[model samples]
Target chain A: MQELMGLYTKKEVYKRFDEMNLMELLTNSLKVQMKHIHIENNQTLLSVNDNKKVYFILKGIVAAQKDDELLYFRGKNHFIGLESILFNEESELTMTSIGRVEVIEFSKAEIVEFLMGLQEGWLYCYLISKDLNHLLVRNYFNFQAKPYERSKIMLNDLAKEFGESSDEHVLLPKKFTLAILTNYLGISYVTMRKILETLRNENFIVRSDKQKEICIHTKLF
Target chain B: MQELMGLYTKKEVYKRFDEMNLMELLTNSLKVQMKHIHIENNQTLLSVNDNKKVYFILKGIVAAQKDDELLYFRGKNHFIGLESILFNEESELTMTSIGRVEVIEFSKAEIVEFLMGLQEGWLYCYLISKDLNHLLVRNYFNFQAKPYERSKIMLNDLAKEFGESSDEHVLLPKKFTLAILTNYLGISYVTMRKILETLRNENFIVRSDKQKEICIHTKLF
Candidate 1:
């Protein structure tokens, strides 16, 4: 529970509720059941076959995948498995832990009941819809852009979001393999590998000896 | 008011409200003020420069456009200028009337007040959010598919939604011109025209010169 508080605080999840006047409703609706689980570097936390449940990442990193390809990574404070829960459908994408991770799970029945009881549940739903819409639009634009251009845009977004000012770089787990990059860019795996190699040789990114993680070398370029 | 009744039978709107479970709330929220305006073909109904107000199409066809390129043709029961109204932002798209049109306008202030007053307003908001998300996904998928393939998908959706069982044809207004189709498919104007011609020659669709409309030749092949 203490660890859960730290992760949620870092993620600003409850702050977001206050911004939308949904803190009370969300708190009352959610009964936090915390769990600790050890996941291998590439093991799935949740998959298409799993039942719908909302998961809040308490620690470590989890990457979303589709068709055996990595799509995106969610770190502490982020929530995943929302689409399946919202539509009451099977998960369309898989969530895999890039490293050992912990998460809090909320059942769909409790969520539905919570929403029904809340005065601001409708507002929360509307906000989620808006966020999903934005994601789709961003994906569309990314798909339309050239492969290298798309990669650059994604890297820039990540740099801005997760980059530490002192380091000017961010470490991404090896779980974000070439297959994941290709799936996200909607390009061929071969092309993605070639591009990664080119970027590495140019010093735009540095891959460790283990080749399981990457560090952006901002000053090199 | 009587003519307005013809545009959307109170029964039809009520049916939609029931499906959404907003019957009582919608009825209480809406303050009906009907207006009639003669709109010449291809004349602007709402421009990108216009003030933010949501309008419900009561009669005739209205086309939404961006940068002079037609995007969508909306008919009865469809709402326009909603994006601007909801976001309190300037219109990002222009809306034009394809023919003589009648609509009911609701100011954003009034609508917001009404929404806040209703207990189920959040439900309506959630539904709208869900709808916007769906539209974004549809647009993303459309852009991913080939131009011709995109047209086929659009035709199939239209047929399924509006086709007459006996005739096996779906009639669409001239407002759905080539420019609109191109915008919807996110393809070039020349490509959209070429695909339209190909479909026409292949007898996949038939154009009515007298009525100035297109009819699907059959269900999806």
Candidate 2:
């Protein structure tokens, strides 16, 4: 129990889980199982037809994609695949590990049991509902805006969220290519490329050669 | 208590509320104080800046609008002013009663106490989250489609969900004006009017003089 508590504390969701009385359920139905898997660049971690499994990222980053377009990235302390289980629907997006990774998996049955047993299962549902709604709202806003406006807003929001103060750069993995950016922003590839080029020329983004990744330039902020 | 129970039973939300143990909370915290007020056509039921009070519609229909665009309509057995109370933010939309109406009101403080004391407070939050998320998702889908496509899809969905079976003509509220339809479909008025004309010419919809509202002229199913 102590070891489990320590492991959970290391994961930030533990605090929220405890507040929602999820910890007790987890303790009752929790099983800790770990597996190490090597995923080559772009290898899929989850697929549309795959059985729903909760994943805790132990190492490396995983990106969610739909039709080769990156939805978002999940890294340490973040989880994915809860949506399918909650809605009893097949996975709508694919998850691919960017590199070799280790993760712990929880089955849908276990999760359902835990949720059913919790005194505050609705809190979990509420949190998930809010997240899904926020995602939908973001998508709606992106779709309603023109390509240029969408790109500007996306970059601005990313910069605000993940940009470092010292460097004024937001570091995102190289796995998030132009295709992914276009899909996430609900824009076309050509438009995304043109916007990127324009931003780069205007000193809003700086590209690094070694990493083959781009960062928002300080002026963009 | 008897009067409150009668009102609760009349509202369909009570069924779900009871399943989640919310009825006990409401019955314990609330007393039935009936008030009669009349809303002239298109008059505001709850304005954007009005104090956050929970209102249950006893009669008539109320429509929600934001930025002068109609979003949705609520008839009997529905609660209003929840968004503001839940988020502690000002109402982003104006709610207007379509006709003369009556409603039961409870202050935010009273409602908050009722929720806080319940085991199902989290469930209430979850339900609200789900409702908001569904609305956002619908808006996203509306944005994703082209103007004409969006109108078609929305009309189809409304027909599926709310269309009534009839011998002569299928009836829907005339309140669904071009502006409201366009806003719900996330399209421009020009586009919506074009689609409506197309549907009208094709006999997919029939305008009635008696009700003077929109009705399905053809069996879409």
TM-score of each: 0.67, 0.68
lDDT per model, in order?
0.57, 0.58
Per-residue alpha-carbon lDDT of model 1 for B82-201, expressed as tens digits? Answer: 543243545555788866787766665455556555544433444454554555555555544667877877766655543444466666555566655556666777886788778778
For residue A8, what is the lDDT in candidate 1? 57
Model 2 residue A70 CA deviation (Å) reads: 7.4
Minimum summed lDDT over a 10-residue window in model 1 chain B is located at B17-26
Which candidate ranks first by DockQ, i.e. highest? 2
Recovered native contacts in candidate 1, as a fraction?
Answer: 0.43
Each candidate's DockQ: 0.27, 0.30
Clashing residue pairs found in predicted model 2: none
Report the alpha-carbon TM-score of model 1 versus the true structure. Answer: 0.67
Candidate 2 lDDT, B7-126, residue by residue in tens: 544345435553224333454554423344556777776775775566767676777766565665666656676543333345556888765667766666566555656544544554
| Docking quality (DockQ) of candidate 1 | 0.27
**Global lDDT for candidate 2?**
0.58
